[model samples]
Target chain A: MSEKIVITGGTGFVGTHLILELLEQSDAELFCLVRAKNTSAEQRLHQQLAEVIQGSDYAPELINQVKKRCHAIEADLQGDITSLATFIPSGVSQFWHCAASLNYEERFAAEIYDINVEGTRKALALARALNVDCLNYVSTAYVAGRNTGVILESPMAEVQSSNVYESSKVEAEQLIYAQQDMKYRIFRPSIVIGHSRTYHAINFSGMYGFLRRLIQFKGMMARVQRGYLERESIRMNVDPDVPINLVPVDKVAKQAVAIARSDSSNTIFHLTNRTVPTVGEALEVLFSTVGLPPPKIVQDTTQYAWIDEKFNEK
Target chain B: MPNEIFVIGTGRCGSTLISNILNHHPDVLSLSEFFTFVTDLGTLIPQAFPAIQINGAQFWQIVSGIYAKQNIMLAHDIAMKEVLYPFKTDVRFNASTGVPAILQTTLPHLTPKYDALFDQIHTVITARGMATAEAHYHALFGWLAAHFGKSIWVERSGGSLRVIERLYQHFPNAKFLHIVRDGRDCALSMQRHNGFKMVLLVFQITEILGIDPYESDDRSWQDDLPDELISFLPESFSGKDFLAYDVPPSLYGHYWSGEIMAGLDVLDRIPAAQQLTLQYESIPNRHPQYH
Candidate 1:
């Protein structure tokens, strides 16, 4: 008999990849918790899965297999999920909670708390109600906020976080630990991007937000003066030598599922890239791709001119 | 001087709420913003601790002196929301006419008849002979606690953690309740606060000009100050412009972390038994009334 798995955030970037990984790795019947917007939950999950699978160079028959094995139960993790325990089938061995609000701005702080912290509370309650064998949580590696030094793949100490999103994740991780009796496994993935092979991204934020702004600025500047970007340089107040850890979604999903399948008990796995890229290295690729001059990374702003400030604002 | 406890934290970390909670307790006489009002921003440690002995008149002057930041805020009509003194109802002091340092937050937080309380405190504080500043504080807080029929006193001022070392020197026997919140939330709250905005701006002024604007008459760096921060200085600062300017929250975040890091060193000097560290997030579970 195949395993029965229940997962939330099946419509998300990492969730779609996880579904593919689970399907490829084992004969598991997937029950996805999806929030219906205009269409049915099943439709939403299928649509996201189709885009993710098609975007990658995977075989066409994967979608058919997904359609056959994967089932979507209409549920909002932010709302009352206690009733979901009855809807989901029994004998489910794995419960993966991947839904989270990625908004890090201060304005959407309350909503972020609602989705990230309180939503986890509801997810945990539903997981308990369902009596799943293990609760597999997808947390962010940035939970170790502002701590300079080596971070271990274990329980985090008291941390001083900089934003609501990271703080909310820290709180969520604490909530998971507070559930001592329940068996659980935690995955802390760093800055997830598009698949390594296809580079197809559903959510265009974080690193991509910077990319979009650069491209948009280039387009705007070209209309004002031909070959303007090629001539003039922009100043960014970023340390070009600083390392940024960016992991691919497919790799994160693959590692997460592999650990989940193993007999690991109450362990934390950091799904991060071994080789991190410097800000200058990443910017070089971006600049070359957009046909713009490389930005002058200025850590000091005392000598910044008006034009330098304006260009950096973009 | 009965039992003493200073509830300290980086400002906007729910210290105000903690002070209010302590105020409601039958055995605790909560002193709100006492240290903040009495000490100047530039000379917080020296002013607060005061190694030398001072007469009643000098102590009264320290208590009633118009703090430069407070004066600026009042003159600009940008008083912090934490200044709970009912300037509208009280005839003696309004925003234009200066409110005494003690009357600003401490006395008003204690009672509705804060004007009468002020008169009573003035009579007691000024009648005393020369004594150490710490001794004067003891007599004052001890007298206040006795007058209110409380057995213990807890003095909580927003951003008191910055001067925790000086506080330890003055009140060596006092227990310290260090209430901390998430730095991000603290920074967000501090960014919105008029008092902290002025303080951060003053900090920038100090860094750029090599002189504390609140302490020195040297306006040498007025021209040297950055264009973005110059408007926030006390001289040209206005309520409208202050609110309109979106000061980066990260500045406050850095300030919060700096204070916490410095405060931890001071806390380490004190015995572990005298200290009680509480997370602002966890306080609700311990004291539900705080909710």
Candidate 2:
């Protein structure tokens, strides 16, 4: 039989795509742990994969292969990990822990710690117990936190997070690194976007949120055109030079699966765009793509004092 | 018939907790925001017409449909009915004139034959496959009653007071518990909560209805009772008849206090045999009087 490989967060954006890519090269039996609430995760995963695969002429046959090999096991990372043990058969070869709460504005800090930090710790414990051949954990490149200017692919001994989410991820990464006996591989991908051609994916993250907001603003403007309200040009401070690294979802999945399959001892691979677009250029492309006039860009970030003031007002 | 208890409070008051607690009661099946009519109309009006703004007649049709199909899944049935007939009447009425006026003119003029035709659509929905409108309502109420197993059914929905009179019209035996907090704190809390901004918009509309906008340290309500709310209240009852229960600004504190007080007030109004009031602080503490 094929090697048994288990992945958590398989229903998520990156995991869903990554699992599909993995099914192609390796004859590994892929299992993903999905949260119980999403009863239709398998269906959703299939639908998303079909959208991506159907468009591609080369990978048309991989659609049925993915459906046949990939299986979703219901278990929440925030809940007891021991419950998941029953799903994994005795001789599991590889385990991938990809689940993490990526929401920036999670109300409680403890919730972030519970899911991101404690959850990783539990996954590591489970991996150790199973005696898995390889444990490939997916983390974010932002685990470097607030440190800007040439973030190396190497792991940092210390991190300083600007937000609770970043801090929790940093903590989780640190916990994973501390597990001395575990044979681990960490894949840190940058802000993932739609597949290369259609710029479409099932999950929404990073630029997707900004795009949604822009679309809403445009809709509001359309309403104003009908004499609802006077059209107002939204202004924002975006540094023209700040490099915004956005890797396409398919590229990230492909690179991650390749790294997982390779015999190289490199424990970490930075799945980031080597040549990233500037913040200004990215915004221009995004607005133009959606048929909206580019926003009036403010040079100084300090000029947008109202943004902070409004948040403080709350 | 099981006693129908409603915990009516502004948004962000501990309605979820109250629902969960009531859910624990063997005789009580407390549901969260079963605003079947509003949610259905909200989705349908936007989807079908797309151009026309939602009005009172569209709302009434949605509500009437829900009342017409109450035996089906309370929420899903209403949603489906609205989707089936997005417009109030077959007249294809002017969108600019608004829904309420359209409904008033259209409903009374419609022959009894048309009403029967509409009712037939609901019956068709009830008889359909798995996840049918009836099944959804059954699952919703059944989950609540079976899980809690209490003799009473309590439903806590945000902005319920906005439609309390209408709700009372349908469930005549229903007792309302309106939980009020300090306006300022409620507004601030609302700024964080999901439906608070919409409620504030409703408050703004109430101001347009010629009521005194009662501004406090927090936010203002028109004359302690907004005109819309005043219209809903019995004509015999004045602004003073509705009681204001003050709550602290802390999370869940305002909600719990308002819920307990609303229940107590309802209990006081009902004949000695019919009502029971339970406090939030007392629930966890296990107060003997409440148990």
Q: After superposition, how far is residue A19 of candidate 2 from its true place, in Å?
A: 0.8
DockQ of 1: 0.01
Interface RMSD of 2: 18.2
What interface RMSD do all candidates show, one decimal each?
18.4, 18.2
The candidate that achieves the highest TM-score relative to the unseen native structure? 2
DockQ of each candidate relative to the true complex: 0.01, 0.02
**TM-score of only chain B in every candidate structure:** 0.92, 0.39
TM-score, second chain, candidate 2: 0.39
Q: How would you encode candidate 1's per-residue C-alpha lDDT over A34-117 as one tens digit per residue?
A: 999888999989999999988986687899979999999999876898788898888888899999887776666898899999
Give per-model TM-scores: 0.52, 0.53
Clashes within 3 Å, all models in order: 0, 12
Q: Estimate the Cα RMSD of every predicted model relative to the unseen true structure.
A: 23.1, 19.7
Cα lDDT tens digits for candidate 1, B34-63: 888887542345765667888987888888
